[model samples]
Target: MRFLSRRLVMPNDLNFAGSLFGGRILEWIDEEAYIFASCQLGAKSLVTKHIGAISFETSAFQGDVVEFGLEVKRVGNSSLTITCVVRNKQTKQNICIADDIVFVYINPETRKPEPHGKTKAELDAEVLDI
Candidate 1:
């Protein structure tokens, strides 16, 4: 499933360079992915397993609205892979600052990989595309 959302980049998200901090961006990505995955699976408790390969390219300034484009790349029997790209929207430009974010999530109560509620073939189709 695809979930696209936007959030305001306020002053608190900025660092000394007048751009958003790396930690804040990471936190936002995690929160957004968790929400997206849970909403798709109709689950209440979503726990993060692994978050890997984060790269920050362009920096975002304070007051810039960030766009997060999210999708489910691959879903396994017990785990789902979600990808997200964050962009800075400014002056008639949608700049893709950082992308290719991946997250593996699990069921919080069971402490195991969460089912993606999709068939293997369906999951594979998404995997191939991503």
Candidate 2:
């Protein structure tokens, strides 16, 4: 898994209980996953197809730094499956994990799934470029 981005938790990001909001973390995960998929597939036309079971193991409070890590699990004909983990940057404690998030490459004109024409080797090579 590559830790790609970090976010600083702020007061506005907190829930009434003063921990980071679940919806906000999910939003970050979705955005990070989309960016990762776009770079790996080298295409901008992609949509999130599915996200597997999510496990919220711990809480993050305001002023904490959290990191988002993602790893490609599988590359299919038109979809890429990835796993995500968000952890506390300071302690490396996992706060949330999603086992699988699927993104489908789509034809911009037709709005239908299209082959991304990328192999695992190709995707790994792109990671080196990043």
Top TM-score model: 2
For all predicted structures, in order, the TM-scores are 0.74, 0.95
Q: Give the TM-score of candidate 2.
A: 0.95
How close is each model in CA RMSD to the real structure?
A: 4.4, 1.1
lDDT of each: 0.68, 0.94
Candidate 2 per-residue lDDT over residues 6-54, each given as its tens digit: 9999999999999999999999999999998898887999999999999
What's model 1's TM-score?
0.74
The top-ranked prediction according to lDDT is 2
Residue 26 alpha-carbon offset, candidate 2, angstroms:
0.5
User: Taking the candidates one at a time, how many backbone clashes does each contain?
Assistant: 0, 0
- The CA-based lDDT of model 2 is what? 0.94
Which residue pairs show collisions in model 2?
none
C-alpha RMSD of candidate 2: 1.1
